[model samples]
Target: MQAFAYVACAHKKTNLTNLLISFKDVSIRHFNTLVFEDLNFSLEKGQHWALVGNSGSGKSTFLDFIMGKASMARGEAYYPYFDQHIQEHHQDDPLFNRYKLITQVSARHEFRNLSNTSDFYYQQRFNSCDSEDADTVSTYLSSIKVVNPSGLWTIQKATEWLKLTYLLDKELIKLSNGETKRLMLAAALIKNPVLLLLDNPLNGLDVSARQDFNELIREISESGISIIMATPATEIPESITHVAVLESGKMIIQCKKYEFKPISFHTIGQIQTNQDELKQLLSATPSVVYDTIIGMEDVSIKYGDKQILDGVNWQVRQGQRWALTGHNGAGKSTLLSLINGDNPQAFANKIILFDQPKGSGESIWEIKKKIGYVSPEFFQYFPTGSTCLQVIESGFDDTLGLFRVSGKSRAETSLRWMTLLHISEFAGALIRNVPVSIQRICMLARAMVKNPSLLILDEPCLGLDVERQEQFKNLIDTICSMTDLSLIYVSHYQEEMPLSITHSLKLEQGRVV
Candidate 1:
């Protein structure tokens, strides 16, 4: 389709603005895994669209294609003639500026995923080439809210975004996964693309940051720049003019601005689950309080100079459920290092698991076998490229399938959990292929496969939304009922707490308050 003057584009076009970006019968694949096929979407100058789907649903891959970093193997991605055509007509027309199509994937991976191959003078993975003018770039950086640390920087807008995302303290060469994700989000917002194509814009932001992002999205969309974004589940702004639903990489439904959302699918909208009643029911059952699975008396842990956990006297009673709630830097996780003594490499102050002091004669591996842990950091240490099932199975030994010998029941055990989480379909899928939400379920399944008496979850809902959170709580409640598992749950949201936990262990400023 040729360009039409803008009348809200997408068949609602009454004005003569040209179609800025449109693709037909498009299909894309990442190496061997097929992301999506026969996918068709279009964007005009003023429309705001949401590409909503679950994680591993090729949302980011779609954005990659639009950004010119990914290939279109089986369809046409037609860009409307603007500056190139305008030059042919009037070489001096100011209205014919070249359209730059940028997407979130542009800054996703600095290690190798970046399609731009032009080498820089000074090479660093995280820090890019310095801008043409250092002082000038510094001003741009500050606009994105970066206070230049060195005071010699120039025109580096992206670096400021990285700072705003809390990457300022991290070295350019040593960016963590979370740091990288933050960098990507910051990059997309700063570029101000004519038609911004975002894939899971809320991927790495916190709850409050999400509210900030909502404001940012509204501001950008209000500027009439246009946006096409994908999300699993989030409260979107009222500015979203169109919505599309996809299943198994196929477009199941598509609707116009006003005609959206009255239609529903069976699996789409369902109360599905809420385990608060079961939590209360389980709370009534008498807890064994099995002789202090772990204990700490006036224990204070000092790392170099900073004392993370100070004057900490606590107990992990056998078969008693408890949760640790605090802010991000608060000692919830550091306290876990105090509780989790299943491994020798991990250390803390006066940690005693199962009545055996971790530093004593007890075998660390055996202790690990009795204590199940699920955390985002744990998943980070897990086999990076393993399939979801492999990661889940490895939890039995806390190794990458090395703790135990070759097994016959491993797949069966893993499958049992994969089915429970509604993620059996992703058993063979690579961990990196799925979203963090799915990976978290897989991580929880890995912990569940071992069936430990003491289960420690460190922010188990790292990337889960309301739907997946309910699914997880249901499974956890069932486990609490069927086994003697005592939960040491950690979370930021009280709403996510399963009332099965009768004990309260709140932390404030790294001290039990």
Candidate 2:
């Protein structure tokens, strides 16, 4: 179990200079099903490994094992000796102090669930609140556990290195996804972790944010820190030195990055359709004329001391789709909130939803009836107790549970949509027990079950693997082609945009720039 390595490909060999981690004949089981059977994996002192896999391929479970959060039924795992070996024993050595796993879900949880914020922060967008009283970015950074937090100079240097100096005084909640990620990276660097384990770190970032993070990863690797990251094959970073492909909980193949090539799980062929076929598939009517569906004039939102949106003007008409683009903290979510009637600030803004003016005193229920919304946050709050069929049925009333009968016709329509989405087998299964990819499809089915005029999707493809993403993207394209649904799709990943999106509105620093 000591430091050792093995030969790989000709050019992508594992250098045995120093071993960081090793596993022999590892077997992991969940509910009597083997996740990893007699699997052997190794990590050396200075190499970047990409754990590539599709959804439900157990990539996250493998990562949990590395993080010491997953227990193996049988296996031999090894790590380097730490200073704690003297105080107690090698078994008591802390493995995570030198290892960091940057996951997409946990980052969001930290933003929403972990942040200790005041009610004013969530309820209001603008007010003469004390910025001085807000917890500054620097205060949040100091909370990260580090070996030498007293090293203020080191922390300051890391801050500048990550370009977070301007955000030092900004409230943590005000920071965007990319900004928060940078802050987390700074904290990881301050701890001087020798091995950094990341899970889909690039999933929710825009092009600029992804580039910035890529450069940061290169810099961190250059500083002598080894990195092991997990991402789908389609989204794997070019800097990866080695690659491992997991299939059905097994390491089907492991090789050098240069020797690696993608293996597609399904043949994604071209979608073919004529005008009539497209209309029938999407339930679209070509005869419909254009009309305004959403309007915002000189709309502005301010909360405490921060301005989220400023004098923004936008319009969405019938049969027209729009893509919302921006960096993290660009007020994309806030803008959607205003349209969805979730934010009280919407009442103060000059906004119109489905021809109904915001200040017109429209009931929340009435506004919601004409619009369908889906997001990662919504998935977290979706009712888990309901069956998949029941969940889809609830979309008719915009309620979490099935109270009133949707009628036989409505029930048949929901079943048809589920079948079209290839999830009919799980119709009776609890929505909570379904895989995330399936859950997304179910939510999408529910969103479209009512066939509302407006659809708001916020990062709908965030956690999906490459295969599921492609399937979902195609499904969205089909939805757009066949239906007259006006889409306000908000996503950082431009590649995930639906084919139906024709126009874009970009936001920068609370302004439509």
Candidate 3:
């Protein structure tokens, strides 16, 4: 196991009166792994910090240390501010002390149904009947017990700040990836904690939402709430006063925000793909060539009185790569569901997929077999019990998890995809035990293992670092160059789009703009 360290920079003149937390020669371990050693850090009351590192570099683990979740092996972690606050106000109430000081909004959230049970699958989001079992955004938010409401963040204020006012009545499972991110932020703010921890907070957000969130973070910091956020170096917000860099579970450098320079540990070299393996995978599932991969005429999707997609007209021809751009709740997911045959409403609409008309004799599995797909929702709800190899193998059958024993050839192909994605080491690891970024890479491998004719990547790079994002983009370009694969790529950042995208479609309020 690799050891990790964190480098924190602070001014020489430290005021004890304003000191929030301090760690002295802190050694920590998680399970049997030594994550950090001799970690010395301090956070003042007014400073906001950003932890910048690659995947599995202990950024999230460091956040856990601050939340008193890490198993400390040596030294002392003193929380002066928290201690004083608790002693001054609620010394007798242990529960209040445990719940009032800090809150964390992780990169991945586990949402429950209205029955308060997590008995749901990945496809439940697309099924209208199953989706209704989830609590509404309003209900979810209202159910959180506020430990200490300082009049800083009310439910209304938090929703308005996160731009979640329109999604109050929407079911939690039905919200878009970006929408769910906002709801999570809102729920955190409602707790009114003195210290807030955000792990990759801007990952799933759209461009506008990210900008709004940065400003909101600034507001929250100004209102006396200190924040420690884990994010990419390029995404460190203006609100952050200091920055800490961690690599290989060790802190290499720390400096003021203005003094910090972003570092790229992984070089963007040419990715060498095994031509014979690629040929074998591509030829394994030969697809029928069609002039129009997808054709939609006056397509409209409605649920009850609300309109999701309104008279949308779009066409995707074979081998054409498309960039699908839209803000949060702009119906981008809904549009993709129609093409992927997940939504039953497609039967009522004049939609054509893979040269076949809707309501044809073709089954949904047949349609899914020809189209490789990956999205944030899929990653969030994916079964974590299976090993990464099993998850990748499941792609061949277009199922959520591996249902039957995979053949030797299928397992070999899956390992090849995992190796190509640089996640071969985790092939034997269960999805639940790895970091979120590793799990995301596994999902990407699953989408490509089948070598389908059409590929739909919905914010595929959501939780990846700068290095992984570049690598995946390069892989996408390489695959398109080698095969006749059509692509419908959705991303908020223009730079994140693959160079293969030659056409674009933008949506606003469910209408093509």
> Which candidate wins on lDDT?
3
Q: Give the residue spans of candidate 2 off by over 4 A.
A: 1-17, 30-33, 81-108, 111-136, 148-154, 169-175, 262-290, 380-416, 425-436
Please say which candidate is ahead in lDDT: 2 or 3: 3
- Candidate order by TM-score, decreasing, is 3, 2, 1
lDDT of 3 by residue, 1-513 (tens): 333333344554456998888888888786456888888788889989999877788898888777766789888878888889889878888677643678898867878887876655766767789889988899899998786766488999999888888889988888888898888889988988889999999877888888787789888998788899998887888989888887766766767887776543233444455666666666777666888899999999887777999999999999999999999999999999998888888898998888888888999999998888999887776777899999999998988889998889989989987776667998888886677778877887788887788999999887777667777888788788888899999999888999889999999999999
For model 2, state the Cα shift of residue 145 in Å.
1.4
lDDT of each: 0.59, 0.69, 0.83
Task: List the pairs of residues colliding in candidate 3.
Answer: 4-249, 5-249, 5-250, 5-251
Decide which is better by TM-score, 1 or 3.
Answer: 3
Return the lDDT, model 3, position 205. 89
Task: Kindly give the number of clashing pairs for every candidate.
Answer: 18, 7, 4
Residues 56-174 of candidate 1: C-alpha lDDT, one tens digit per residue = 55656666666665677798876664343445654665643443434454323433222234322211321223312122222323444222232222224445534443435333322
Candidate maximizing TM-score: 3
| lDDT by residue for model 2 (203-270), tens | 56667767777677777677666678877675567667788877678887788877766643233443
